[model samples]
Target: MSVLIQYYNDFISRSADPRVKQWVFMDNPLPTLAIIAVYLLLVLKILPLYMKNRKPFNLTRIIRLYNIFQVVACILLIYMYLTAGWIQGEYSIGCAPVDWSNKPNALRMVGTFYWLYCLKGVELVETIFFALRKKFNQISGLHVYHHSSTFFLTWIGCKFVGGGMASVPSMLNSFIHVLMYTYYYMSSLGPEWQKKLRPWKPRLTICQMIQFTILIIHSLSAFHPECDIPKYFMLLYLPNLVLIFKMFYDFYKDSYKSKSASLNHHQREKKIS
Candidate 1:
């Protein structure tokens, strides 16, 4: 372990910049692919057993557990974010701008990034539970895509983008998770309670879209003369986000339209019958 740490430190030292070092780490490709493989295997193995039992999906318990996990994880992430500032000798949240390429700070950032990446892996349990409960309809393409992509993206961020423009999206994502998780906790009880609270699911989706947009813009900004990010990777990053945003928007619109149409159809059928 000590030798591995020394090797990582030496590699970080020799790299041109934090982003370059991160890219090297992401270039490994093996760990992320392995995770996806395990996720698929687990889903295949458990889904049939869940179907055979015919158990009703238990939303309440799932929500409670999810809420607990998010609340705790959010708190811990916030603490780490603050500590990173302290390590940089910045006493306040608004102190000196963070230098993403600074070695000590970059190392700390990578460590936190790893924590967040592992959290994404842990979150796979959400999908597994859904599969087990036979709530397959809820497991849409967006759902699976987001889960799988986030795991890989977080891995890439930790390994290749930990200290550069890419970190902005990561930091924003953590903040959003705080809000998203709290909303989930409140909405978990039942429809009656959710009606009273009137939580904004659309707003959450909008926030997510905004986050991706910011990330894309930030990646582009690295093209300026002083920025160190390679042109090739920057070019690669932008188009993927465009596709991601379009997919999320379409999913949002379709979901609302489908729900409304279902309600209208139900009313019409009642009148005709």
Candidate 2:
């Protein structure tokens, strides 16, 4: 155990992106691990036990506020990435490697990556809310896995390569999240509003599917011998990307395709009658 710890500390000291090593939660994995540990303990044990005999809190206003904050944060992230280089054609879509320099734009990109990592940590609160409201159904394996893995994954990305190809996925994800959180915000208004937004739910899922597909392709582009951003990052990241994509695909089929098929069968029976 001591040997392993020594090796980890040495590896991080040598390989971490120097610009971000001094940033909050960027110095080591322990803080991030602690956050995840607390999140799991609360949602899986403490919150559930606390809410067992109590009435669920009506968090309509709180949810709406949180959704609004997510929307704004995503917008800011999009702006940060865009102005940094993505929109100005400064980055290669196929394979842009990290700058790793002290140039102003490069540092700005580092800041963007760090903030995105921080945002993932903040997102764990969504699960906390579900637990507090006794919405255990929302805390499915996919939900927990996605939240936990993404938080750790972003931390790794920021600590190593803070810019380049990574910014592409994070930026695109922010755009999709803006749309998603907007839907959540509108749906939180009331039951009638939720009914009105129902059609958009499947559409949102389609958008998520599209995002993951693009990410898979983009991640693979890094493997070209000349791309220069470590292939191992993609090796670690792509599998998780593929896994999450498959999960989302399953959800889409179960949630929408089956319902569509059933509805079509009902229509056919009505016609026969």
Using TM-score, give the best candidate's number.
2
| TM-score for candidate 2, residues paired by index | 0.95
TM-score per candidate, chains pooled? 0.73, 0.95
Model 1 misplaced regions, further than 4 Å: 1-27, 44-53, 57-59, 85-103, 197-199, 231-236, 257-273
| Prediction 1 TM-score vs. true | 0.73
Give the Cα lDDT of each candidate: 0.69, 0.91
Model 2: per-residue lDDT, tens digit, 121-164? Answer: 99999998898788999898888989999999999999998999
Candidate 2 Cα outliers beyond 4 Å, as residue runs = none
RMSD after Cα superposition, model 1: 6.5
> How many residue pairs clash (N, CA or C atoms closer than 3 angstroms) in each of the candidate models, in the order given?
3, 0
Error of 2 at 95 (Å): 0.7
